[model samples]
Target: MLAAMNRHRADGKAGEPVLTHRFLCPASAVSNLRDRLRPQEPWRLGLIVDVELSDLPHVLDAVAHDTRLELETVELRLPGKDRPAHAVDAARAPLGSTDASTYLELAPASPAVPDTLAACADRGFGAKIRCGGTTAAAFPTAAQLAGFLLAAVGLAVPFKATAGLHHAVRYQDPVTGFKHHGFLNLLVAVCHAVEGADPKEVEAALLIDDGPTLAARARGVPDHTATRARQLFVAYGSCSTSEPVDDLAGLGLLESRLA
Candidate 1:
């Protein structure tokens, strides 16, 4: 999951969450997602709509009549059959276009990416990245997304993620069919990247083959891992936190960093 860092305009003060045009594939729960997050706490209700190629029309219908809609981000999945370009258009059409807050998830492309980096540059849409789960962080995983980021930080293609980010540790969820959250890994990697870590290392951290080795090295950073991490998610997601994120700002250690 790439961090969404807002840029500071000439004024010096950081601006709003830069809404990107990219749409994450398969948006999460829309209607009652927030109420579901924490039953006890006070939270604003928002929707995370899914925009599959086949489901685009349906989503349009749902949101068309309803102008007072509250949404986080529309995630688009690039299935073997779904045309990524078309989906991007559909997702962006609803969004106001040029909203950097928007993001897209980059699942492994089928047939061939046809120059994914170039495609992203050409399309000028958000390319969501899968950094965890069965998705490899390199070549076709987070590495690919990182490439987009590293190569085009000035270009402005944003990212969003889902699935596989549950625990903040290196594990797999049979239910979700992706690697569970390796919290420490995410924190270190993001921080490293923020601090100017090489893309190769970020890609290495996202690889399954290299996970064990990375995990061994990560044992030391548990206190900073973002697994079930609070505050940060709230700060980032903006929807209120339930279990994973409630007070991340005050909390010192993440699941991995807790020790």
Candidate 2:
């Protein structure tokens, strides 16, 4: 993803936050990170580290050796069954006054997710949703997606999404056969959320596949509404940036050079 972004920058400088990499407590992580950094790439924006609560100390110890200094964001993935507040407190201790923003990613199926989201919002931490996965079960149902986004909207908290989003509009993968959410679907759904759209309405937007219709709806969004929608939806992770960019170009959402 970072490589694609670097390839696209007209000035040849990295200018966007691409994705987050989990930091394991192994010795190899240090060397792996060092090898990952390249000259003139926006290393900070390209990859943020996600640290598990129990591994925070170990990760901190390992990172102390790196010259990267402060991380852009140290995402704390909360323990699946622990109390939200307890987990937040434990995660906060290791961060200790760093300039990096804190983001919390957790399972939406957890009964306490809403409460945990509230706690994260109160602390100004961003929220993350695992949208889809390599398998079908990893994907959240429309109800689940709507519920989480609606809850975030009510709390005025920003959120990011990951996995299963590889196209501009919803479609089934030819090889894997798993149905995936579309980035445009999500952006439009987010615009609805920003304008206080109901969960069903947001869900409706997610399931739409008509390319021109969806593009028209996206274009209809007012500039101010688009800004607010972007504020809440933030960004998402795509395995191939070109796939989505190409999809958008094909759909006329983006200008095509070949046209």
Candidate 3:
């Protein structure tokens, strides 16, 4: 990945996209990953730790070795199926002093979601949601997702999403039959949530499956609203870069030249 980034920088084409890398690993492996990634200096690196086997302070110390590497978020994975709020409270003391964000991979349908999001906001941490995964169970229903958005926005907590958002429009896989959340749908939903739209209207945006209709709504978002929406949504992870760009260009949302 560093080699690819270096090559892209070497090309030096006008208006070339900036490349960044996000590494997801266990807390114990952070030091090793930092050592391996240190040679590539001045790169924007975001780290997401999935498990907390090691001390968080140690993990933060490892990230400190590389000035460019940021400990973006640490996932609180408690055993024995503890509540999400418990996990958030357990992390407050150790993570309180650091600027690194913390999140729990809690399902929006979980009864603990509202309290968990509230706890996260109280501690200055962000929320993380799984948009989709290999299994159908990983996908949250439209209403569940909308409820989460409304809660997070009301609390003024930023959030990040991961997995199964490679496409621009909502779709169900023909083979696996797992419905995927559209990145475009998420963007519009965030805009509505920030604008104080009602819950039903926000959920309606997520339920829209027509590509042209969703694209038109995305284009209709004003610049200021989009910027404010992004501040709350923060970031989302996708496996393929070209797939989303292609989808956006095909929908007339992005310029063909950029694609």
Candidate 4:
């Protein structure tokens, strides 16, 4: 993955690589992770780990030495239902001097999402949402996702999404027939949320399935609105790098050399 990113960066064809590497590892594996950390350019890195790991501080300390990788954020995996303030406090206890931002991963279906996002805003932490997974149950309904977006916007809390957003527009896989949310759909929804659109309107954006229509909506977003939206919806994870570029090119939103 790093090699492919480097090649793209060198070619300067597809634009700068906004690639990130997120991993799940134990504190004991810090040495192994250090050995594997080699990036040609500065790249954002995220670590998903248990909040109660014993050697987390040491692991973070070791990771901070790598100038090539920026420790963008550390995601805390809560063991069970806990108060948001308490969870953030516990996660911060282990970080002695490491300055990486912290975020609490919230399930989209959890009823406590709104309150948790509020706490994140109060405590200077970000939020993470799971957009999709292997099973159909992992994907949140349009209404559910809209609720999350609205709450995050209202609280002024930044967030990043992970999993299942491979294409630029919402699509149903022909092989599995599972519906997947599009990153572009999410971007347009963010624009709506930032502009104080109601939940129904935001949900409508998420439910858009037509590629051209969705692409037009994304393109129509005003530059200022798009900037504000991106400030709140910081980043998202995608499984395939080429898939998004291909989708945007196909939608006439980007230039591509692919035939």
Candidate 5:
């Protein structure tokens, strides 16, 4: 079963986010991140992939070296079928504070993805669901993807996503010719459909299918520090970039941002 959501796209540039074929990495690393990211001045509350600062002894280690850093989360690439168990081993590696403070990865592709999610739920693990909003696989419709999100919840997949989403508009990228994030719409449906909703009920939410409608389902749901569902939707608002900065600003999820 398709378990999570993710985002990965690549622009061939000297210092661009590393993504292509299928992967995401910091474009380049430097001690002066503030100057480079050119962050929106005020800064935002989110994890910026400091590959240099990451733990887990993987590719990220090349940048951080052996020095331990205080990080809230980091993405890990699971090797293979044994990755679930492998992750456990990494977490237990004891690189001191330098190791993974908290690890995340594309919720595995094996049965392990869903299984790991369920297990983590019982243990309250933080796992991000990696969805493909940029693929050509044609697995299912956007609505079906929403079903998978709710199903993950039913099975107890803790942290999840509708990644790759970047718009409130429903259209394909004219360039790469792939679908981009319509996250507000997707999660809106998932949250509504998941609240005491079933597969068939989820089906209705999917059918209703509008950003405001979906967001409305979440009305009065409450929020907090470690809550996954709320965080997923909140993140969705920022990452969507399907349209040109100005055009998308007025048309898509840009309207959904909170002050």
Candidate 6:
């Protein structure tokens, strides 16, 4: 994975390779940290640990003050009602100098989600929405996703997405038959949302399957819109970083940074 990232030269420094993005490691994924550290190439920009809400206390106890790890974010899966608040409260006491960013994952339709996002924004945290999984149930419907985007935008909260977004355009996975949200589509939709586009308009953008057309729209996003959208949409995690980069290149929306 590191080799692939380096070959892409996404760090914008020829022959001076870096990850160009933060590598998210699950709390238990110690080997990833070791491998990244071994390179000693500044390959990682930041570290985010995925922690379960129930285990946050223990997680914090273990790493809250560990100077070795420059922890930037913690994404917590809300176990139940009001759990987002619980996670935020649990994290606040030990926030320390890291100024750790936090995100809560919740069902888009959950009644408590809007309030949770609002509270998270007020507390300087954000939200995370699961975009896909091995099963269809893991994916949010266009309406559901639009709702999440609207709520986040309305509350001035930033959010990140995870899983099953391996392609640039929305399409059905040949193996799973699950419709996956396109990473480009999501980015463009967020750009629209940051510009105050309605949920219906954002949903239409998310449902676009034409890769080039969607890429064109995304490329046309203004510099200011990109900045704000980056703040609100933040970054997403993908199992294979190369795939999304390849898709972007295919759409003519990206250029190789290599000299």
For this target, which candidate reaches the highest lDDT against the unseen true structure? 4
Instruction: Please give the clash total of every predicted structure, in order.
Output: 42, 0, 0, 0, 12, 0
- lDDT string for model 5 (1-259, tens) is 0111122212222222211112223324323332333233221112334433333245334435413222334444333456565554443343344433333444433446555555445543455545454466532455555555665656645443435545453446788776554544455555654465666665555445344554455454445312555543323223423343333344332343323
Cα-based TM-score, every candidate:
0.47, 0.80, 0.83, 0.85, 0.54, 0.81
lDDT of 1 at 218: 49
The candidate that achieves the highest TM-score relative to the unseen native structure: 4
Q: Per the 3 Å backbone cut-off, how many clashing residue pairs does candidate 1 have?
A: 42
Note each model's CA RMSD in angstroms. Answer: 10.8, 4.3, 3.4, 3.5, 9.2, 4.0
Q: Which ten residues in a row have the lowest lDDT in candidate 3?
A: 11-20
Regions of model 4 farther than 4 Å from truth: 1-30, 37-43, 50-52, 255-259
lDDT of 2 by residue, 75-97 (tens): 55665466887776665776656
TM-score head-to-head 5 vs 6, winner:
6
Tens-digit lDDT track of model 3 for 64-138: 666867666565543235565667766665554666566656678887778888878876778888888878888
Between 2 and 6, whose lDDT is larger?
A: 6
Q: Write the per-residue lDDT of candidate 4 for residues 11-39, one digit (tens) a residue.
A: 35445244334433445555665565565
- Candidate 4 Cα deviation (angstroms), residue 21: 8.7
Model 4 gets an lDDT of 0.77
Higher-ranked by lDDT: 5 or 6? 6
Superposition TM-score, candidate 3 onto the true structure: 0.83
lDDT head-to-head 4 vs 6, winner: 4
Q: Which ten residues in a row have the lowest lDDT in candidate 1?
A: 2-11
